[model samples]
Target: MPRNAAQTEIYDALGVGFGPSNLALAIALSEQPERLRTRYLERTRQFGWHRDMLIDDATMQVSFLKDLVTPRNPVSRHSFVAYLHQARRFHSFVNQKTLFPTRIEFHKYLEWAASDFEHLVRYGQTVTEIGAWQDQGAVTAWAVTATGPDGELSTTLTRNLVVATGLTPSLPAGVRTSRRIWHSSSFLSNLRDWQPPDRPRIAVIGAGQSAAEITAHLYKQHEAAEIYSVYSRYGYTQSDDSPYANQVFDPQAVDDFYYADQQTKQSLYRYHANTNYSAVDQDLIEELYRRQYSDTVSGRERLRVVNLAKISQVREIGDKVRIELSSPHLDGPLDVDLAIFATGYRPMDTDGILAPVLSHCDLGEDGRPLIGRDYRIATRPHVTAAIYLQGGTEASHGISSSLLSNTATRAGEIADSLTRTGRAATTLPVSVPQE
Candidate 1:
């Protein structure tokens, strides 16, 4: 194992998760080295985003223009087009005028972006906690705890922290992931461990893109397996991400959503949440519909979609799993062998890590972090340095907080804010030695 820390303290104005969001932040920081000290931490030993679902033909929901650094810095060398060129795919990409790239290709592009600033990122490191402190009336520093590859523990001190740790996959209330039951995030790996049964019956819960994709993937991979899909929606709804409506996800939308009244925010969420979250891609929806039709015409109706149903009980029964699904359409309950949940994920809380220094940070009535326009944490009167945020901005910044739409602009704006804040004065320096 390598050494966990160096002799000197490493002071960072920003620490990020090294994904596309933070990758954009890193790219911006690289351009303005004189103003920012940024470090990106990745738990995986490498950079990858949604690798498990890098299905063979799956394409990005959004256009390629919404890449890591294009909207804010189109001429950037770190742009997706630049990445494609580096990988020798630019010529082929131009031949196909489609702005949406395949999942596999996009994953490769992300890895390429991650490799550019290899020195600014620390792989095989997981941030375990974040603690804040006050110095001369403003939030000055944050102590970040991380575990190294060989289980060694270390802490890094920084003036600003951007938590882009990503979402936490959630299963139905009573269902838990096991060898038999799996979430879509771990679908590919788990499937590799099992030999296809002669007459396997797999139950996928959810009507969203992930759920539908899993249902389709399983149906195509397993010949004799009966795929049962359960969801509350009557049928999969195609996302309304058409040109006119997609502008709702623009960087300016964040400002509009943030300043709006409580009722307006809730109204916007109700109207547009499906654009990014609950709805399936239009092409995917049509493909699934076509497959269902083909199955019906052939009298092999193994691919089933049990709409408006909910999974009530899930239990692992030896090699096979049994699940009980409930719905208004069903008389009692439907049973299945294995259940795969494509429900979704929730945000991670930094509040516990911030507890020891809680008095330094402010909170809103909803118990969420009180975030400002530039995605800075509203600190208590006693704190001074800036505390940047890259996650959990949904409530304050709107739906695009966790999505890739506003990433380029958001990261640049945050970097600009950090530069404007200037150096913090302190009685003692709190920095993590260079690793």
Candidate 2:
């Protein structure tokens, strides 16, 4: 690649990240009749979606029909069924009679879909900055810079920008992770590297699906060890997947959510929080309870459910960590060999990347970026460069903003917006958008 951007090469759109959000956008762009030159930058060496947490038996919560393109264009070759058929497993999959496929299988389907756009993505390049591309006094495009594979800077210009950098792993305040401590995002990898002693003490914090899954996995893997499931709740809450309640993810619901007042939106979130929050599947909860009860019946209870508890403090003492566990049932602190936090993730803050160009964008009353119904950031009239968000729109777009449930439809909407914006500004500069 070149050190300096080619003066004549201005992309119609540039995607900052190549995760499922942008991947769906790529597919939509490619399938659209009016093509706009587009490229995606990803920091990873290859495409992967939650690689470390693809537990063998874990199935996707969302249905296979929600694959990258099926909801928007059922005939697309990138659909999950198409992948299964191309991989010669369609008949076998049909025999299973399940709407959700294994997470591993779905990830492979994503890779299969991604393979078609290998030529359009720049892997191992992390975006570092997005600045205004000015012509005279008008900000006409975005000047994007990224750290190349070898640490060199590669800059490019684009008329339209889509940021889908995804979320950041969240940890409670004052809690830090070490070799023995980990967040659920890298659970499998860390566990693989861990060499546990005989009858080790392991604690998993949080009451989410990840925490429950880790509890089950650890119980299975470490038969002789003590596995503690510590959480504030008295027991695990079952996720709400009932048919009527599931309408929260419908495309029309997004419109309802968007138009609702702020108070109504908050109420909606509170009402539907069980759908995708700190909850576990009912089947898994039953399985865990069965295991716990069986151990109790055998007089060899290795799995301990420390309910209504919170970890007050954690300190490393050589190989093991001393956890200051506070609970109504506990008499003292509990120490563990390893601790895993499945506290979930927070939306990635893009202030750093958008710093240079943010002043030109409008803000809501709460002082955050004011994103419109089309997912475009509200900007001043003089600014012609369009910027869109592919994730972190939950506050404005509803619960499915950052989920796979509405990814295909959302992508199609963004792609439609980009195409219309492109057609309206046909007089803008054009060249091959590449390094």
Candidate 3:
């Protein structure tokens, strides 16, 4: 951990995570007239956006024009186009004439943008708890406690809190990860460290994009290995990226979803679940199908697609894993060297971190936080300090809440709300620490 100053200063706004969402917020705050004393805490040692799953050939699902700042402020210096221009690849990138860039390139672009806000971000710190400060029976501010890299404790006071801790990786119920079991979020890193046998048999579970990509990658990387793709679906479904379907992720759609009734919100999610749910790219789906078809023709089947199947149980044997397959066509248990669950992620629930201060805020009938259109939590009138959320508002904000699609626009909206509410100005006496 870096040397710290006397822990007396209070910031106007403090962000919990420094991912693309909050990084966009930091940039949005920079554009404000009054310099909002801001700080961001990140658990990782450095900036990285989905580093483990950044496969070589995998490209972003969103267009390049919908980058960190273009949707909100096209002239911002932190846009992807700006990064490409700074790297002397603008003309070359334009010559390629592709709407989507490779995942690795987008990660690099995020890192480049994060470098400009190094002074406002503190790495290697994990926020443990957030407590509210009361004055005259009203909550006035918040105290954020975080654990440093060396196990030291520190607290920062702030008038506004923005929780952007990002999504949490999820696995099946009653299933725990071990040396032989893994999740797709850590796929590349874990594969690099594991020592597999001669003919390793691996099973990747799920029908999502990550599952297909991992199955393809394992087949290409481990030539002597057998790969099994287990999913309950009949086959991998192509994602709905058509023009009409893509409108659900538009900025105006957010307003529609936010203002709609509860029943309408439920219907909207059910109707457009294919846009971002367990679906794969058309090209990747065809590629995997072609490989499977060619293997069948050559009588050398290395990739096995186990569709209409569900994993009943996973037991650890001597040196392998016994995965019980349950379906109309299957019978006994199948043994594999390793099992990878590409099960998708869930939003970071605020109930845990905000437990101590939850009583001050209002919740809906479903027991979820009541988030306003501006992304601020609807707390009691006495609680003056603003508690904003950068993610975890999919129910109210729409599907783009946890994605990079509306990140820049969302951040700008939060910044504008804070500025208009007169919460951007700080009364702290000390100056911001220099990087």
Candidate 4:
């Protein structure tokens, strides 16, 4: 049934963050705005994804085949190919003869996607909290607290909410970052301002691709610098990008993952988690290894891989960072001048805000939401409106939650569900002014 125009309350299905996950959602809604009443809220003034880590030589982990819209609907006007054409760089891209686009190119593609639905996004706004309106047993409306531009606070009422608050980077528990110590996520942003004499020793911590990339980058940038790469693993694990293993990321995999029982889902995650983390691209691994071998033969020893080692402590003294490395297998402790933690990110928890409403929603034994196949948080007898999830759906929806493979498809599915199952009144009240 269509909503009544006489309803005075403002209706919206808000998106909490504007990363690629929710940007895909915005695009999906823009393509069919009449159906889904939605608005996107972003903390930043504009769309960005790990901009501080946008290293020039870095490339996307996935291929162009896994763009925002292609897998689900190749002919859609919002495909990366269409963005390239719109930017008038199709021919130039063709000359590159590379199936994978650079990190810069992918970031630009994300910006293009965000721009396609500028009307739906509220930048420079942070969603601080979400509360539910109780009418009998069901959740009638969602109360959203957002801090807008000019330091003003506002509240908007919505029928449904999509939480896409993305991941936050994590360093080792004890390590403290300062002017000298830094994480790889902020490497590019902070590196330019950091000045040091030539032939300095720098230590990069981790066996992942980012650590290797940063090592190579610093090596190339500083001709006489010595790089010490440390990792708990004996060697970098190679990613499984073979045709058959890669099929695990196909669109159909979502069905397989969704239908699988808890144990099966765990098995799948354990089996394929290497595709993203704890692994390095085969080509990159080979190249870094080759560089290490060349350095050994030349007797320069510029690149040192301290395998089975971990940084025990990091202390910053003015412009230099002192890193203490330890390993049970090694006899003595080794100290380095700088330490870079290439560790990854953790999911953003809505607990602080959602704590008041936790009893209304269904939760798993682990205290996480029991997300349905459509990415909606499972609620109790109460809470009629949907609370969709984007990034933190991995526990219920599988590995595609934080991944780039199923973003467009996920957004389209969510939009379809919202339009077909629920209705929101977009008409303004007779007494209220329309914007």
Quote the positional error of residue 94 for candidate 3 in Å.
1.6
Give a tens-digit lDDT track for model 1, residues 338-417.
Answer: 77889988764566555566566687887665889999888776666557778778887898998888888998998777
Residues forming the 10-long window of minimal summed lDDT in candidate 3: 424-433
After superposition, which runs of candidate 2 have C-alpha atoms over 4 Å from their true positions? 1-8, 429-435
Better of 3 and 4 by TM-score: 3
Cα misplacement distance, residue 322 of candidate 3 (Å): 1.1
lDDT of 2 at 314: 84
Model 3: per-residue lDDT, tens digit, 1-435?
Answer: 123534466777899999999999989889788677889999999999988899879999999888888999989888999899999999999999999999999999999989999999999999989998666676667888899999998888778899999999999887888999999999889999999999999989999999999999898889998998999999999999999999998999999999998899999999888999999999999999999999999888899888899787888999898989886656688799999999989887777888888888898888777999999999988787778998899989988899888888999999898776535334322243444
Top candidate on TM-score is: 2
lDDT of 4 at 295: 90
Sort the candidates on TM-score, descending order.
Answer: 2, 3, 1, 4
User: Residue 21 error for model 1, in Å?
Assistant: 1.1
lDDT of 4 at 415: 78
Per-residue CA lDDT of model 4 for 1-435, tens digit only, reads 012323435455878888988887776766775666678788999889889878777888888767877776778787889989999999999899988898899999888877877888889998777877655545666777788878877666677788888777788988877766788889987788877666677888887878878888887787788888888998999988788778777768888998998999999999888887868888888888898899989999888888888667777766677666776554565445567788877766677656766787898898877878888888887556668888776776777678887888898888777665455423322122234
In model 2, how large is the Cα lDDT of residue 255? 97
> How should the candidates be ordered by lDDT, best one leading?
2, 3, 1, 4
**TM-score for every candidate vs. truth?**
0.92, 0.96, 0.95, 0.90
Candidate 4: Cα lDDT at 133:
61
Q: How much does candidate 4 score in TM-score?
A: 0.90
Clashing pairs in 2: none
